[model samples]
Target chain A: MQASEFSRWTEENAVYAVPKTIIRVGQGERSTAIEGAVTEDFLIRTLKDLIEQGR
Target chain B: MSPLSDRDRQTLREMFRDLKYPVHLQLFVEDGNQGSDNAKVLVREVVRVMPDLLRLDVFERSRDSLLAALYGVWEVPTLILCDQKREDSGIRFIGLPSGYEFAALIEALLDVSQNRIRLSEKSLNFIRNVEDDIILDVFVAPT
Candidate 1:
């Protein structure tokens, strides 16, 4: 997929899985890799590179 | 106990209705990781409902340490999405992807199945002109 395609498709729709509720983790009772908008952005940028080159 | 209630299951079923290609959700679990158990059942139900769009590949860390380590998994209950050839898509979860993160699990599959990403033109440009190897990691912590 091209860069633009990668950007558009992933941002529009991103998927992930997690427990029913994220209580707390880490040193200061924080979320460990909380997945949401940040995750969508990450996936949007990351998927194409993986899908295209298998990297 | 089944964590996913009827409503949530229906929600997931609808969310994953339009996946274009098939996606394999690779799970790596070690002993004493209760999160992996919940995640396993959740994913099982999801794939059970959407048999065409998703598949589950499970590996015990002790049994599949080589493959598990390939994905940089040093902890239990790591979830990664794989393409048709079972290549990692760089979308990974260190802990159980539940609660709000459940959406991410579904979309990771959708993105791979469809082979698409949605980003701003600026982000796309950066991804386009990249000439060197780049490692991308996104972290979220409640502060």
Candidate 2:
């Protein structure tokens, strides 16, 4: 949540360097189904799980 | 616009330390769109956290490029995983990864990075031996 807390967590647990990309989609567009906004908590949790499993 | 909090970035950096294969994220965006700015911010934030394990590439496709459809990237926030050998096994999401879809995105990334899909052994065998490029399109809502 807070920037400081997030920064501290990142500093301690970072292990290996893996390549990743984040694609941002616009809302209310017609071509695809990204109809609304996505929250930060959701993305962080998802990414954390994905990375943890790697270890 | 920042997609990852500080803690999330740290966790990702730690997880990436064990990665055997490289992860590449290609961001598809349309110019002159309001959402593009937010998308850019998210992309930048992710990169800031795990610079080694993640890289973001932006492609501004023309109407023809977008319509012609190579990789079935119909949306801006679509993520594709490429193995070490430069082979593509299509894993796609139709919306921004938030809520349940956020977890899905991470799972997809792990699957791609590890080159291990959760499919049964039979399905895994089927996918491994196949020579042709396999394109998979998954559609989901942010619940």
TM-score of each: 0.64, 0.55
- Least accurate stretch of 10 residues (summed lDDT) in model 1 chain B? B134-143
Number of the predicted model whose TM-score against the real structure is largest: 1
lDDT of 1 at B81: 90
Output the TM-score of candidate 1: 0.64
Worst 10 residues of 2 chain A by lDDT: A26-35
TM-score of chain B of each: 0.83, 0.71
Which tens-of-lDDT digit does each residue in B1-143 have in candidate 1?
A: 78778998788778777787788988888766787777778778878878876889888988998987788888768888988777778788667777767777777788888887777777778668655444433334323
- At residue B67, candidate 1 shows an lDDT of 89
User: List-wise, what DockQ does each model earn?
Assistant: 0.04, 0.02
lDDT of 2 by residue, A1-55 (tens): 1226434633443412222223222221211212234354544344344434444
Alpha-carbon lDDT, every model: 0.67, 0.52
Residue-level lDDT tens digits of model 1 in A1-55: 1226434634433324321112122222222233445554654444444434532
